[model samples]
Target: MELQHREIPVEFLQRLPDGIKIVKRHGKEFMVVEQVLGPGGENLMSDAVHIHGEPSIRLGVRINGQEGLIFVDAFWGGHAKLYSFVPDLAGAAAEVDAFVPETRASLMVNRACDVDGCDCTRSIVLTLPDGKSRVYVCARFGCPGHAIEIADLPPTVSQTISSINFFGVGGSEDDWLDQF
Candidate 1:
């Protein structure tokens, strides 16, 4: 199936529970996508923003950075928070997890801030169920903390390829993720 993308703006977010926070001190919302861990990961397709953990079934959110995979051990409760460059929120809705690795991610991306438009660029290497790793580039942007998933999904593009880089923070297979 061809990977499709959708863009949700900060001005169009829905209301969470009574006391749920949705924004960061800096105030920047990003298109966030999550995959739930399977016995070892998260239920990515389901937005368990409120209930994000299954201690017996730990899920993780691994950001593909310039250096390598930065895996964060996510939980289902306690200290739930979000970070952003926009300043207007106490914190955004996110799964409660004990951030692992305890280090900053190395993101050598072409990030920019525009008045009405912006698209960050990067490449990702996704390992499929079969242990076969394929690169993916997010084609669009999504709202952080929202759960919208497409599973058992195959790389719509790239053949006999090494890597691919994608545009937009949400990913859309438009970029190439490579290593050679």
Candidate 2:
């Protein structure tokens, strides 16, 4: 499916919360996650692993009873992930239990994914520097479902920002986007 790139809401840019920033890539502006914390306030940004030329958000995850490390893209609405160990996702709706790699604090929240055809009821929550703002990602592997909630911004603005997918749906790395 073709991914639609939505313009970043001006209100959000004016009141951009901490831990998230706007970046210029190929002369185009994009929102990126600069930092995120686990439930125990452990920094989940890994400088050692970079995705899309930026530090990745690292997390420990257990999928289908197999535990491993996952480095995720920091770009907002991006779903690129690198797994330390291959997960045997028997089906598309497989769920994951995500936690802090250092403190093991649970990052899973009881939130249902809004993506159609996906029945995942759990989400991985990443707290932004502002504390009140959060980024929620669907726990189901291969599901590009995520949402952003900013404390000061309107819910509609946050929702609109959450819908920006640069690499297209399913996080397909199409080189065509690089031309922009």
Candidate 3:
């Protein structure tokens, strides 16, 4: 399926685990977001997100070995239970349970430019721990995933990835992409 690039707000990304990228935003400039991959790793958008005055959008990322059972089942539609798989550490921080609706908001909240002015093309990618990336095109008019339905989305996002404010992470875009 052709993924349509959708715009999202900044606040939505804040709900994630951390280390997610705001990429860029400018006074309501649109941040691109998309459902790009199946599992493991996926980018939030299909292409770059451009706002009129900002440089970031809201999004959380998660991947293999991190997401707990609730997120795993709701997002991937799989029967695997992370909590059950590793019962000893059931209450681990990484194993924190996320409300399905709030989880979907992280992705669907930004359906268009906050001002209804401009929504740019974006790309999404899923990066596995192995250091490989899988790209997906952001949806145009993204599906407003219902709170009840969000329980079925793969929790491939985390706050740790977005909260990464590398002091000397270099000010160049290429510098960041290189790390991914």
Candidate 4:
């Protein structure tokens, strides 16, 4: 089935996880997934890991332009979780995550972008004044890039950031993808 006017295919729905669905509002396309839950049975979105799940982690499939660019915004959890097993979803999948530098503008050591089917670790870090910074894109050109954010960085990175005294870092090891 196709959405009104946009003619964008709806079959992509079959490619996503159970809790995720797509919707169009005001001519823009968006994917909406239920917020994940925390270990204590609390709404993690309201406590820690705010705005990192659900509609925040959008799955964008190209409508016409390049024909297969699947763009997913930065999300919490490991990139492996983001890489779905769905077939025929073409084009490169671009994902972004956040990271915090230990020192001012310190060079980020090379780490492979962990998004499934991707192997790039090089990234361009954009540091903010409050240490809430983001890595814009993959260092490699054209392939899908993983955006590294403190909210979404792997557990090891999160632990490291907290150890260094970065501000506004939260997301327990027990954070559930269903708590959004």
The prediction achieving the highest lDDT against the true structure is 2
Question: Against the true structure, candidate 2 has what lDDT?
Answer: 0.86
Report the C-alpha lDDT of model 4 over 1-180, residue by residue, as the tens digit: 122222323433333333334555456554433442222222212222224343332222222132221223323222212222233324354333322211122223466654455676655443322244333345443344444344333555533322221111242322423332
On TM-score, the candidate that comes out on top is: 2
For candidate 3, what is the TM-score? 0.18
What would the per-residue lDDT of candidate 3 be over residues 11-116, giving only the tens digit for each residue? 3454421222234322322222223322324333212432222222223433233543221211111111223233344322221222122334233222222212
Q: Taking the candidates one at a time, how many backbone clashes does each contain? A: 30, 0, 67, 17
What does the lDDT read for residue 108 in candidate 1?
Answer: 22
Local distance difference test, per candidate? 0.24, 0.86, 0.26, 0.33
Q: On TM-score, who's better, 3 or 4?
A: 4
The full ranking of all candidates by TM-score, starting with the best, is 2, 4, 1, 3
Q: Judge candidate 3 at residue 143 and give its lDDT.
A: 16
Compared with the true structure, the alpha-carbon lDDT of candidate 3 equals: 0.26
Model 4, residue 75: C-alpha shift (Å): 13
lDDT per residue, candidate 2, 1-180, as tens digits? 444455888899999999999998766788999999987779999999998888999999999889999999898877778999999988656788999998889999999897888888999999998789999999988888899999988899988888777766545655533543
Report the Cα lDDT for residue 145, model 3. Answer: 12
lDDT of model 4 at position 24: 51
- Ranked candidates (lDDT, high to low): 2, 4, 3, 1
